[model samples]
Target: MDRPKPCDLVLTLSLSRGRYGVRFAQDPAEVLAAQSLRHRAFFSRTGQSNASALDVDAFDSTARHVIIFDLASADLVACYRVQFLEGAEIAQAYSAQFYDLTALADFPGILMELGRFCLHPEHHDPDILRLAWAAMAHLVDQAGVSLLFGCSSFLGADPLRHAAAIGHLSARIAPPDRLARAKTADRVALNAFAGMGTAAEAMAGTPALLRTYLGMGAWVSDHAVVDRTMDTVHVLTGVEIAKIPPARAKALRQIVTDCLGYNNTVSAMH
Candidate 1:
C-alpha cells in the first residue's frame, strides 16, 4: 500500500431522487477528476502549495475512493477516500500523518481509514449529503469493515471558536477500548478548554461530517492538533461499525436499499 498507484472503485449507486449519483473511482481519469474536485474544495481554499492543479496524493492509489456527482452539472460534488488496513501496518494510512496510532495495532479484521472527505462549497444541502452518506454506509457493509477511523477537523487551525465542539466530544465520547489511545502528540481536553465539567452542547460549531460521526457513536482524540498545511485543527476520530447509532443506522440502511436496491444480508447496515 506504500507505492504510487491507482485505486479501484468497487461499485456505484445513483440516487432515485435524480440530482446525484455515487460511484467508486474506476480508473485514473476518475481519480484525477476527484483530485481536481479536492483541489477546489480543499487546497484551493486553503492557499496551500500543491504539486499540481489537482490535489493528488500517494494514498489515491491504494484507497477506495467514493465520488458523488451532480447529474445536472455532470460535475463532482463530493468525495471520500477509504483505505483498507491489513495486519498492523496502519502507519501506511493517511491518519498516521496526524496522530500516533500505535494503540490501534491490535484492531481486528478490516479497518477502513477514511480521509480527504470533501464536499463542494456550493452544494452543502442535506439531500446530496444524504446520498453521500448512504454511499458510505454501503461501503462499510460491502467491505465488511470492522472499524472506521480518520482525522476530524475544524477550519482555520484555531481552537478558539471550536473549543466547545471538540471539547464536548472529548468529554462525552470515549472509544470502545483505550487500546486505541494515542502514543504521542499534544491534545486538547475539550471540557477543560470550554470550562465545562461535562459535555457541552456546541453542535453549531461542529462540522456536519464530524457531527454525523459523533451521532453514530464515533469517538475523537483527547485534543486537536494544528495542521498548517491544511489550515485546520484536527482530532483523530474512530467509529465501530456494529456500534453505529440505531436511528442513524436505520436511515443509512434505507439509503443503501432505496438507492441501490441493496439486499439485507448487510443487515441494518444495508
Candidate 2:
C-alpha cells in the first residue's frame, strides 16, 4: 500500500445533530482545540494547567483529528484522533507504541487506530457520544476500514481499581492469542481478575466508550498497560468490522445515512 497524503484520509464532510456538529480538523487551530479538550479531560487531575496545557504527541501530525463542537457556542465538546493504516503500516499506529500488534500487521485489511477519545469535562449530554459514533461510522464506510483498534483507558494506573471491568473483558471479549501480546513492561494480566466479579458488576465498572466497543463485538488484549505518565491503565481493543452484529451495523449505517440525507436536504433548500 502506497502512502496516502494526510488530506486523503480526511473526508470533506461535516455532520450535525441537534446543536452539535462533527468535522475533521481543517487547520492547526482546530487541531489545537481538540488537544486542549483532551488536556482538560485527561490531565486536569495532574495540574498541567499552564498556558501550554495541550495534550499532544508525534502522532498528532500523522493522524486526522475529529472534533465535535456546539453549533450555538462554537465550543469543542468532544474529540478523537484516527490514523489510517494498511496491514503493513500497523507499526506506525499509536496503539503500536504500547502493544505488540505484529500479529495484526499481516492481517488482510485496512485498519483505523482511534486514540485520545474524550469529552469536555463539562459536557455531559448523551448526544455527544451518539454523534461521535455516527461520525466514526461515516468515516469507516468512506475509508473502507475493515478494523478499528485503540487503547481503551481506565482512569487510574492501578488495574485492581478496575478489576471488575478488566475481568469482564477477559472473560467475555479477550482477543484470540494471535492478535496481541504483552509487550509493555508495566502491564497487568487481565485473566488474573477474570473471575473476580459478576457480569453485572463488571458492566457497571467498564468505561462507557469501551462498553460501546464491546457491544459491537470488539475484543481486548490479554493485559492492560499501566501508563503512569498518563495516570491510566488501558487495554488494546479491536473490532473487526465484518464481525459486528448485523443489527448493530445496520443501526450505525442508518445514522450515517440519515445524517447525510438530512444535511443534503438542508443544503438543497438553501
Candidate-wise lDDT, in order: 0.71, 0.83
Model 2 is weakest, by summed lDDT over 10 consecutive residues, at 261-270
User: What is the TM-score of candidate 1?
Assistant: 0.83
Regions of candidate 1 where Cα sits further than 4 Å from its true position: 1-16, 47-52, 173-176, 179-192, 196-201, 261-270
lDDT of 1 by residue, 149-265 (tens): 888888876777677676677655555553345543545555567553334357777888888888888877776777766778788888888888788889889977777652212
lDDT of 2 at 29: 86
Clashing pairs in 2: none
For every candidate structure, what is the RMSD over all alpha carbons to the true structure, in angstroms? 6.1, 3.4
**Residue 186, candidate 2: C-alpha displacement in angstroms:** 0.4
- Worst lDDT run of 10 residues, candidate 1, spans 261-270
